[model samples]
Target chain A: MARATGCLAVSLGTALQICLLFGTASLLSVGGGNSVVPEIQLRAVDTYHWLSAAQFGDLFAIAQAAPGPSMLLVTLVGYKAGGVVGALLATVAMILPAGVIVHVVARFWQSSSGARWHVAMERGLAPVAIGLVAASGAIIARTTEHSPAQLALTAAATLVLCATKLNPLFLVAAAGIAGWLGLV
Target chain B: MSRDRPSSDVSLGRLAATFCQIALASFGGGLSAWSRKVVVEDRGWMTDEEFLSAMTLCRVLPGANQVNLAIYVGSKLRGPRGAVAAVLGLIAVPVLIVLVLGYLYFRNGSVPATQSILRGITAVAVAMTFAMAYKTGAKALRSLPAWVLCAASFLLSAVFRVPLPVMLAIVAPVALWWAWPARPDASP
Candidate 1:
């Protein structure tokens, strides 16, 4: 772990920047991790030139395939910007603010467990959150799927996932094999 | 079945270890399901009702849902230090794994050999995002108003490229109004 981060010389300025970017993103990432993905892509890929859009997509794949949260994409983006230090900083910043908020609210949540507005808020926000989730998918699709074969594969995978209870890792693994074989 | 508060005697090591197991078990998505299984079923740290409510609260808050959940569970059982320990446990190994993968990726600089495989995997990952939307939308978009809200949000972010704050500013009020309980004290 130390050697991996040691590969790059991390600077204070870069550390600060990574912290600022991901910390703000953590709070704004209402709905879930995917909600902030487009913004992170915009900053990390377009503004900062830390990585290519394709690389961002690739990292997203790796994060998804890996264990833990898909939000680990933020770590990859940080790594591109500042190496291992950037990765750790980004992950911490991404979770800290939101983590604090949840910690504080969790206290209030216990007390307000059955409040009427609470139920209303829950029902009311569900559709909106679902929409944001779909938008994230659309954004990712735009970034990742270019070739006809890739696009078709994405569509097919989506269909399979929606129609069946089959685990997604199988789809990802099969797709990787297909790619390795140059089938897609 | 026990609706009373759980004992706070759980050690920090146990909290961390449980979450570590949950994180490792949650590869390829389904972190939430894994968390419920472990926290509510296996460990009995929280009852079904408490876990379900905490799940909703975690989602409703701003952080990554799973991370926020870890915080909630940790704090509930062991206060702030427990929260830190649980989160570290949840992410420690995974962070190392991701960093190693990332190092290999950057070092190779997109070799043609692995490019094809990554391309294939990227497609499935993208599909997973859409599948999540569909699964959630199926339950949430049963009514016309819900569909309208869902579509509006999709268009705003996906097509118009609106920032999140602005998008929520436009749609959230209307959604809350539509969803507010008709009776102030009616049974759910």
Candidate 2:
């Protein structure tokens, strides 16, 4: 009886913690979800000790393989920590605050398209945004890269994507086949 | 710039399903490209310029840029209900798949075969990201100020290890000042 009650208490606490942590991440994702990856890692792996660093890495791989938003990682984290309820809480918490912010900004942006400041903002910030996108790619590359073979694959893929009209999903499939065959 | 705007006749369910189809198709990254293809080209929801600007705004706002984009398009089409349908449709399947993957991983433990498949997929995934960055960066690099900002941002955030927010704070002010709206008398 005591153990049952203790289990319930622990699960509830874990659920709440997931909500708070993910809620913070929701607001802090300034340059999209990737921007807050490190923070999310720290809290889930280091602070909470809910999962090991290795587990986090595996989860990341799984999230990448699955479809939808890359931010599905939060759902995985919440599931590991607290079960189904925790997963729901974490997913909702991760997206809701930012969703609200986005809706408000969208409304403002729709109305202010021709405003001078809006024009300036649209023009000025574009490069900065592009640069950030570039930086994110580089960061992801540095982390995943292992061998010269992998680097070559990346370069070839980039060229193919930029130079051809080939569908990207086919390229991804080819790469996956290579991996499955132990080629790449 | 005015072409046919999105028809007001687009039902809420269709809006949800369209976004869902996009989600299904976006196997890799580059949701923006697929978004443009579907919303701008196929559906004639908005002009390309409108989509690009909305995409830029979405990138800055918190949350997943694509998710925000769905909301932006949804709201533009059908008010608050539009947002609900779009977001729900976008995330529902992905969330389910992710949870299932999570379950399987822990249940079976790490298998060498699964890792192999994931690594391959991930390698291509990373490459897709590289292509996207290059494609977009090429466009931004057309202007000198934009190019300079791009190079500086890449160096600081990727190479020097400065955090994203800090890097943005350092570079954004300068970039924005350079690109600020021109005053009539100040024009050279």
Candidate 3:
């Protein structure tokens, strides 16, 4: 077992780090959680060496499957780094600052019809966010599309989703079956 | 655009419950679809147009779109307190579940069935994202110039591998100009 430090110190330090990660990711998340995956990959796999690339990918997949935001990978990383205490610390840290900020902003927005500059800001942001989303898709495709079979699966899934009104779960199930069969 | 009177009919409790439902039911990144259903279709919390506008606003905000969305929806329904309640409920429940699951997974090195299920979900998520992009783009890309901006940004990011922030800095201003041009009457 890893050495057990004072609970308060571990909690506080882990919480602080989690807050910083969540805050920076939130502020810079123009395109959403998917857009921030590369940054998370860099920090978790490359910088800290907490997990290998494959492990990180697996964590991401699990995060997506579970629920809530895709950013929940933070919790898994924290767990790996420090255990249950770390997971709690990270979860609280990741949420608190952004929650406060949004609450404050919501209050201000409620009372005031936002100024023209605020409207202008949204207009300016929309395309940037869209571009970021596109970039995120490209990055995920690059990283995950390692084989011809995987590429075909991705392409077929994309086409099915685009062309038909079929629920997306069907595509996912088919791909999983293929993966299970070692087809991709 | 119209500054209508705020509706007093929507209850805070109902809104909070709806947000919790969204959070819990939103397995496999289902918040976007669940949001469309609850807010726009089921609850009539907001009109379809209002829901779309809120989605856009949430996307640009500095948080998970779902969390940001809870804030927007709650605030719209009641006030700041409602926003706080909604967001807290949405996050706390999910966090608890995820933490417990994480603990279990840590103890056990792998869960094969879970892994397989996620592989399936990932394939679907990718497709869903693409479809969402197309739908959103089609609605927002009203002009030829707007399409040009979308195409250019896509190519620059997808093909050239330009960093996203830099690409946005280059394309966003142009898109703004195209979408809401300066009116002759308003200009000095």
Candidate 4:
């Protein structure tokens, strides 16, 4: 009985921690979902020891492989640590604060019509967002596999993606086939 | 390709269902395009201009851009309750699906075949990011100052390994100042 109670206590505590951790992540996520990945790593892997860096990477891959938003990886993280309850807590905590901010800001923007700063802010941030997104891409490439074939493939992809209108998912599937066959 | 923009009385249920469809459809990136097709063209919830501007804002703000966008669109349509409904619809299903995938991965993570497949996919995923960079970066890579800013921002985070928020703090003010709307009567 005591051990079961202890287990419950620990899980509840960890679930709460997941909430706070993700809440902080949402607030600090300046660039986008991908931007806060390292922070998520720091918390889930480093601080909490819920999963190793490799496991975190695997979860990311799975999230990518599975259909849906990339941010759903947080659900994986939560489930790994504390099961379904943890996943629910993490997802809610991760989005609610940010959602409220968007809501409140939208309200503010609606009320403050004709605000000149709005357009200026949008114009200025557009370029910054663009650069940061590229930076994010670079970071992902660097952090993921960096074998020679992968590097060559990435280079090829860069040229092709910039030039062509082909869908990326098809390329991803092709790459998977090559990988499965030990080509890449 | 669907040409049916929803009528103006976007109920909370309709908002939820629409975002839910977007969430399910967007896989392996292209969330933005999917959102555009649905929100701007399909529902006419927002004009193209409104959609573009909101997208830029979503990217600029914190959290997931898509999720933030859902919030923005919902709030624009029907305030806080709408925002909640939209986000729930967008994520609830995806979360369950991802967790199931995670479970399978955890169970079979040691398999050689699984590892190999992941290996290939990871490489391609990296490439997609590069492609994403190029696609988005082209827009801002037009002018000299924009190029300089892009390079500086890119180098700071990608090359120099600076944290994103820190780089944002350093770059945002200068970039904004440079992009400040020019006076109408200013000399050409």
What would the per-residue lDDT of candidate 3 be over residues B1-188, giving only the tens digit for each residue? 22223545556666667777876655544466557555754566665434544665665556677777788777766777777777766766666766666656655756446554445445455555565565455455655665676678778878887765576577767755654525422311
- Model 2 CAPRI quality: medium
Q: Candidates ranked by DockQ, best first?
A: 2, 4, 1, 3
- For residues B87-179, write the lDDT of model 2, one tens digit per residue: 888888888877777777777876334556555666676666666666655555677877888788779878898876688689878876886
Residue by residue across A96-157, what tens digits does model 2's lDDT show? 99999888889888887666666666666666666666676677768776767767887898
The TM-score obtained by model 1 is 0.68
Instruction: Please identify which of the two predictions, 1 or 2, would achieve the higher DockQ against the true structure.
Output: 2
Arranged by TM-score with the best first, the candidates are 2, 4, 3, 1
In the order shown, the candidates' DockQ scores are 0.49, 0.52, 0.34, 0.50
Mark the regions of model 2 whose C-alpha exceeds 4 Å error after superposition: A1-17, A34-57, B1-10, B26-56, B137-140, B183-188
For candidate 3, write residues A1-184 as lDDT tens digits: 2423222335465456555665676566664556667876786677656567886777776676676766677777767655666666666565556656666775565454344433443444444444444555666667555667666666777677667767555565676677777676
Evaluated on the second chain alone, the candidates' TM-scores are 0.60, 0.71, 0.70, 0.64
The candidates' interface RMSDs, in order, read 4.2, 3.5, 4.8, 4.1
lDDT of each: 0.79, 0.75, 0.61, 0.71
Query: Per-residue CA lDDT of candidate 4, range B1-188, in tens?
Result: 34443533578898899989887755444466557657865676775445545765676678888899899888888788888888887887888778667666667774223556656766666665566556555554567877887788778877898876688789878877776667633211
Query: Which regions of candidate 4 deviate over 4 angstroms?
Result: A1-25, A28-65, A69-73, A80-82, A107-114, B1-62, B105-113, B119-141, B183-188
Considering the two chains of model 3, state its CAPRI-style docking category.
acceptable
Per residue, candidate 1 scores C-alpha lDDT tens digits across A38-61 of 999998877777888998998997
Among incorrect, acceptable, medium and high, the docking class of model 4 is medium
Instruction: Point out where model 3 deviates above 4 Å.
Output: A1-61, A77-86, A106-135, A145-184, B1-61, B161-164, B181-188
